[model samples]
Target: MLETYCNASGQRVNNEKSSIFFSKGCPQVTRDGIKNTLQVHDEQLSDRYLGMPTDVGQAKNGTFKYLKDRVWEKIK
Candidate 1:
């Protein structure tokens, strides 16, 4: 589950170096083709994509399993 927020306003407002609006919830994982439909909020923001968790461990608990699996596979 990955969450992303965009700043549609393009005001170049510095949200304290934070690009995301708010993403503390689990994001639904769907096929690439269905991703567009799942994005219910099409509201444009000022920035592009930002504020995503770079580390797998930092992700939500529910999404941790998937991240771990990928990491383990890479180690093999």
Candidate 2:
């Protein structure tokens, strides 16, 4: 699958600036396999992009508290 994409695009993807992210419940062993399969480094998902949660998980309860704290800090 990766071979097909790279071949079709004829472009190289920079792994340093690019990454793959797995959901929280993914087992470490599975994560490792997926990362290796993708041939890119794993990276943390940014909580906020332009002052908003980047994904649904980050926007949900408890997790969003961090962003709220940042907002409160600026308002205060």
Candidate 2: which stretches are off by over 4 Å? 47-53, 57-76
Poorest 10 consecutive residues by lDDT, candidate 1? 40-49
**For model 2, what is the alpha-carbon lDDT of residue 69?**
87
| lDDT (tens digit, per residue) of candidate 2 on 1-76 | 8678889999877777666777889998988887787777656787566777677655387757787888899999
Give the CA lDDT, 0 to 100, for residue 10 in model 1.
37
Once superposed on the true structure, which residue ranges of model 1 sit more than 4 Å away at CA? 1-59
TM-score for each model? 0.25, 0.54
- Report the number of the highest-lDDT candidate: 2
Q: List the global CA lDDT of all models.
A: 0.43, 0.76
Please report how far candidate 2 places residue 54 from its true position, in Å: 3.4
